[model samples]
Target: MKEFLSFIKKEFRHIFRDRRTILIVLVMPIVQIILFGFAVSTEVHDARVDVVGDLADPSVRQTVARIDQNPYLHVTAVLGSVAEVAERFRAGKSDVAVCFERNFDERLRHYDKAFIRILGDGSDPNTAQMIVNYVNGVLSTVQSELSASEGTQTASFPHVQYMYNPAVRSSYNFVPGVMGLILMLVCSMMTAISIVREKESGTLELLLVSPIRPVGVIVSKAIPYLALSLINLVTILLLARFVLGVPLRGSLFLLAVMSVLFILASLGIGLLISVVSATQKTALLISGMGLTMPTMIFSGIIFPCESMPVILQYVSDIIPAKWYIIMVKKIMIEGVGFSYIYPEFIILLVMTLFLLVVSVRLFKRRL
Candidate 1:
């Protein structure tokens, strides 16, 4: 009994002595719980809604007011014409557009029915549906209030329309997210592990003493992974388009260019991970825990960042996958051109440059 107790005490001491392992075991659960509890939600909030109709009409104005007042929706613009709805959506300014038909009040009084069209950006089908549901709920409440005052039923409802993805297919939403995930997994994890393996095998030291520059070595190692990532990108695109029935609505050339930029950004992240990691196992662990988890959770891939807490939303801003996913959706589903997605492009460009410079500097110091 004494010997067994001593062995148990030694095991506890060993565990407590390793701070990294202790930190992982203790901190990981707390962080994940906080993130999942506070940062992930299915509910929509502050979704940009565009209202197009005669604000002068009492009924139309009332309904718009109700929608604006709803906690989940925000009336970002009140447009003069229905035609502007499409223009706003194309410009990525609106998530949901509420267009009241002409003579909305008269139709409600005479025919007991008035039509309002609700247009949603269906690139993210789940969010689009939620926005429409919230709008409908507000309209329903307003209808009830107006009907009660008039002592009759007011048959006024929105005719919902979804652009880009008319059917609101889940596949449309998942493909881009999956693309981002696969790229990060392949580019970051593989590159980091590969570099670490070379170091473990002592080949890195041999290469360092040779004539090749450190930057060149890193680039050469990254090029193969970059090429593989491109191939994987093509495969995912083909699968999304042909196998999954997700349409490629925009310029394929533009999609390719943006995808290439994203690939470079991912490779840069991998290089940075490689520079920091001392062993293959360490590289794999960091790439998995640091890169994969954040990419999957906080990048607006599975959850809408708008619904997240303010702090998590801000943290998501630094995630490269977030920008890549946005770019993909805007280009492939929204059919927008470079002008609309330039901000995402600029962010990715800056991240790639920053990671590359840091990795190169670190690698040189190590050599």
Candidate 2:
């Protein structure tokens, strides 16, 4: 019995001596719980909206004020012309636009048929629908106030028109999300495991000493996964279009370009993980537990990030999948081109560069 106890103590000491294993075993669960618990939500908050109408009119002004005051919506811009509403959406400045016809107060008072137009960007059909519902609720409250003042029930409310996805298809939302998830799985998980397998077999040292530059070696290793991810992208698009009946309204060329960029970023993450992991099993565990779950939870793939607790929402900004999903939705469903998605593109580029730099430095230290 004493001999067995001594063996157990030695085993535990050996396991605890490896810092990478200790970090993975002890730290990963707590981090994942905090991230998944706090950063995931289904409700919307602070959704960006633009108002276009005569600001001088008392009713129009009141309605805009009410919308601005609502916690769920933020009135970010006031446009001078109704024509600018589309421009606002195309520029990605707003998620929804409220346009009031000229002399809206007078029309409501006399004709009892004033028209308030609610235009929503339906790239995220669910969010677009929710925004419209919130807008309608605000309009209803304003109409009630007007009716109470006039001592009549003759106030007309706004009519909503959803652009890009009038039908509010769920597939439109899921396609981009699925695309992001699959690419993350392929580029991050697969690449990390592959590289760590080489390390486990003791061949990584040989390759490191070879003629190829370290950066070149890493890039070459990633090329196959990059190509595989692109193939998966096309396959998912085809399935989304034909099987799920989701529309690909944007430029396919632009989608392909952005997808490649996202794949590169994912590869960078995998390479960094491989640099830190001592074994292929450790690499797989870290990639799955740390990368995969967070990508699904915090990326706004299944839940709206705005609804998450404020701190978690801030944490989600670091997730590459979040930006990639947003870019894909904008390009595929909103039909916006590179100009509208440049900010996300730049962010992804920065993240990719950071990951690659860290991975390269760490890998050199390992040598």
For residue 303, model 2's alpha carbon misses the true position, in angstroms, by 1.0
Q: 165 in model 2: Cα distance from truth in Å?
A: 1.8
Model 2, residue 310: distance off in Å is 1.3
Q: Which tens-of-lDDT digit does each residue in 1-367 have in candidate 1?
A: 4533453454345335767534443443334333433355455769999988988999998898888888778899999887788889889999999989999998888887888899998888888988888788788888888888878865555555688877555566667777787777767777677678778888888878866667767767676666666767776777677766777888989988878887778888888888888898999899999998998889877778999999999899999989999999988898898999999999998998898777778885354
Instruction: Write down the lDDT of every candidate, Cα atoms only.
Output: 0.78, 0.78
Model 2 residue runs over 4 Å out of place are 1-158, 365-367
- Cand. 2 Cα-lDDT: 0.78
Model 1 alpha-carbon miss at residue 55, Å: 41
Instruction: Kindly provide the TM-score of model 2 when superposed on the true structure, using C-alpha atoms.
Output: 0.59
The residue-by-residue lDDT of candidate 2 on 118-138, one tens digit each, is 999988887798888888888
Candidate 2 residue 327 C-alpha distance from true site, Å: 0.9
